[model samples]
Target: MTAELGGRIREARIARGLSLRAMAAEADISPSLLSQVETGKVQPSVSTLWAIVTCLGLSIDEVLGHSPASREPLRVEHPNPIQRARDAPEIVVENGVTWRGLAVMDPNVDAVLVTYAPGAASSPDDTHMRHPGTEYGYLIRGELTLKIDFETYLIRAGDSFCFSSSRPHLFRNDTDAVAEGVWFVAGRAGAASARSAPGPVRDAVDALDAMSRLPRRVGG
Candidate 1:
């Protein structure tokens, strides 16, 4: 962790093309302290590190080099109870979907596990609110309809799509059973709740993928 922190600090500093002295001044810390951190002679306190990260135009997680998790699926240990959508209780969005969420590199990006129930025609919910973020999804199983703007793509398993959140979109469960897929939502925290315990890397990735399916403009 310390090594990752050091590397992140170094990367941030270099990206800004700022010398240690400059960074120290911008971060309101002593140059000696910066040098010590760079040399791995000392680790900065959380507050100090956050200040440095903010001054360097980086996120708190990025500076710490402790992203939510990797963007790869893994075995789950002590999995939490699945939360089914209130509107689609019979649809069972969680377990029946055969999908998983995982962590990714960006905090603003959420990975999701989207399982579409058969005959579950997706409806755009852009009324009263607008979903704000970019969206992208990849089919993991079965077939489904991906609505973007006014066009619909009959995306099949393994296919992928990306679009802005400003446009309305929805996933229709046009298959005979559940259609499994991954959606990555931008600028939303649909999956990685800071409150949740550290679980499998797959959770993070799945949440990101699910989020990607949300409409950029429509609020769902």
Candidate 2:
């Protein structure tokens, strides 16, 4: 599996027209180091892997090959009597932020349940960045400092937020508490969510997204 992962990484890098040296430069590492990584001669730390993947504009799920089920028939994750943690797949960011999802499809939308350890962040810093879509977030527990378009907003448990992904957005949890949240992003690939989400939850989410745009709304 490890070798396969490395092979996929190398394939993705080449498919993007990046040479080993070019990719090394892009990932801010030496060509020798990147070559070792590609050949699985060395195992990259989570942060190093993250830098390589994001630098190539690929999501961890894509790099790890977790976007297949998403392309299959729509799946309804019905409410279970108990929310048992599945050995289901996940994508880790710096080994601190864990994103568990069935798939991370960029075309339809990328929805994930994310958990952050204390002091963890969506990225290293408040770097200005944006996805090609809209974003909706609901904090399940703890608190977070969400920065959008350079403005920081304190979001706590039960708080939700929605905004155009066109603006730069960043997230971090400075509090000494584990934070968990649900994020829904859409608009680039296709209107898949509109067709996949089941009835009540779908309607409720849409309503919430609409209300989030209103002044002083809780969803905002």
lDDT (CA) per prediction: 0.56, 0.62
Q: Which stretches of candidate 1 lie over 4 Å from their true place?
A: 1-100, 121-130, 190-220
Candidate 2 residue lDDT tens string, 93-175 = 65267766533323345566878799887655535544345788899999998888658999999999998654556778899
TM-score of each: 0.40, 0.47
Task: Say which candidate scores most in TM-score.
Answer: 2
What is candidate 1's lDDT per residue for 1-220, written digit by digit as tens? 6666777788878887999888787666899988777767788897567556545545455555556655332322323333334312112233233333443444566565666667654432322111435678888888987666568789888899887553445666666866777678765443222223433323222333344333322112
Which numbered prediction scores highest in lDDT against the true structure?
2
TM-score of candidate 1 against the unseen true structure: 0.40
lDDT of 1: 0.56
For all candidates, what are the clash counts?
Answer: 37, 1
Worst 10 residues of 1 by lDDT: 87-96
